[model samples]
Target: MRHSASFLPSRKTRIIIGTLVGLFFAIPFVATTEYTFRDVDGHSTIHWANVFDPAKQAAYRPIWTGLGNSLLLMVVTVAIVLFVLAPTMILVNLRFSKLRRIFEFFALLPISIPAVVLVVGLAPIYLVVGRSMGTGAWTLAFAYGILVMPYAFRPIQAAIDSINMSTLSEAARSLGASWPKTVLRVLAPNLRQGLLYASLISVAVVLGEFTIASLLNRQNLQTALLVVSRQDPYVSVIFSLLALLLCFLLLVVIGRAGNVGSHKKGRRK
Candidate 1:
């Protein structure tokens, strides 16, 4: 009891820390919310209501377009994480165990590089991509794949580390399962939590990204907000709040799903 108590903070300390942390985040959100409700006359919900007004659709078209592009990018980025990164990681851990360190070094290299530096390196490559791919906004997913790799890698790697991949793969193979079948049927299910968390993180990163999209002259949610803010700042703030809320909801929902799965498994055992 004494040892456990040593690790736990006193109730007063917990309350003080929680309040400070809450204010740190809540203050800015509250300020932005207040700003969005303010108008030339007084505080009102006109800006909020105008967001859904059909007659004003033309004014918000850029935001809609950017949001659409961002959603597409999010899909493509998650696919890269699922189909490419996760599989490669599994292969490294199971087959090329010795290369795991080297692979991890490269997987995490992007986090050390600044976004501006990455854009500088990617600019020349995107020129070729634009030539071949016709400059579609979805192509930004390639860059985002790299940007989100470090974030995605951590959770997936932790999942990989938790399991006996070689033992599981060998058992599946011995049972007449092909390599592909073993990975898809036996391995992937176990890694679902990591994959889902990685996908969610990738979505958040792609949505919040602005520098690369702006530098590459691509239209995404953040860039569209910048463009719209020039005309109406309220709309931008409203959308920004919505994006934050969406991310928060995704995190909570995914976390709850993981917990539910755990509880079910526990009860079955």
Candidate 2:
């Protein structure tokens, strides 16, 4: 009688699968990168000189401004998530556990709202902000914070769930530590991975965010990239490759943070 194989992929099969998945992503990246290096005649040549041409700097000024704006949005969005969502999530989980589902539902509401719809709804808010705040790209942070809540909330929740928040709080309180002390000292340190993960996701989201900013008559990285594509296709292709590389680096950062967190947990145990 023939024996059934193990109900899992073999080591060789896993390697094959991993290779194919990497190739699936790598193919497009390779094509774009190759195209970026090609001249108008389609001959392969390093385009670094053209990319940094002093005469062409003026042409790419909008893109540089957009990059600065995007980075600002990322920082503000991460801060909002940390200061607002972190405390609120901890409070609900510790004091109003029953409201957890409601909190999650609200966090997820943005995902259901399309970009165009969100932009339409936020128009009045933008008008008020523009009038009060002088219509800078920094104002985009508030909307971006809302958009990234769904992604940011999950890692934070998962991190809290991994540790016994109630026990830690009680222990801290028993030691005469206040609630803020417990959250900032006893709990926050342990949630480093979660915070890093949330920040990484938020950065990625802001980098690619275009619709709301565009409709609001603001510029961002993605919108700037679109303009680049229309004006200088090869340069835009190079930028796309660089964006992908940045994303990969962020993922690597998250992975390292996770490993570090795990190591600390293990040492504590």
Candidate 3:
């Protein structure tokens, strides 16, 4: 039998409540900030538009580079999280227990240390590895992977917990699927939402990261945000609005994906 209707609210009521809650915080954030925008005639301007001009872009080249780094960080972080951390975490938490407990402690240890302490300690280590590796991006990715690890592991474990692994694995084995094939084909499909959430966390962390990038003398989004703010406050506001918009878009995309996935599962059931 379905649950009682008394516990449930209509969709419109929920939307209105959510909208009000969001605007309550968002409005104040914008209001407290004194950043202004203008047109060529000193007229008022739009929010979240491409306010950058081509001729004046020379002043904003650093910003473009920062955006590139941020985007790259998102890509690299997602790749590492999916390929490296996801497998490592799943195998440990699922296949091994005592050993996984020890490793998982180490995995989450970074969260205990202060962000500043980690940044200072990691910079020199990355520099040394960066020199030996010949590709700074890889070393940086490894370091960023450390930051991403904590974000990726918990959700993956949660997703793993929610699934019936023994059934899936047994079914695959009966069908003569190889171990790797079973994991790749059967398990990963089940973990898609966890993967998406992990990727989102990794991307957001990598994009907004400043401490490691600045300490290592590598420019990233947060660093770029700082530089843009110094030269022109309004331009910095423009960049902030752009980042906010991108973040909003990403959440929307994720929600739509989740809805589609839910519908697909309903059809199968």
* Candidate of highest lDDT: 1
TM-score of each: 0.90, 0.87, 0.78
Residue 27 miss distance in model 3 (angstroms): 4.5
Give the alpha-carbon lDDT of every model. Answer: 0.92, 0.87, 0.76
**Considering only N, C-alpha and C atoms within 3 Å, which residue pairs clash in candidate 1?**
none
| Ten-residue stretch with the least lDDT total in model 2 | 1-10
Better of 2 and 3 by lDDT: 2
Error of 3 at 31 (Å): 3.4
lDDT of 1 by residue, 1-269 (tens): 77867978889999999999999989999999999899789899999998999988888999999999999999999999999999999999988999999999999999899989999989999999989998998999999999999999998997898678999999999999999999999999998888889999899999899999999899999999999999888899999999999988887987797687678767978
When 1 and 2 are scored with lDDT, the better candidate is 1
Candidate 1: segments with Cα more than 4 A from true spot: 2-8, 254-269
Candidate 2 backbone clash number: 0
* lDDT value, candidate 3, whole model: 0.76
Error of 1 at 93 (Å): 0.8
List, in order, the clash count of every candidate structure: 0, 0, 0
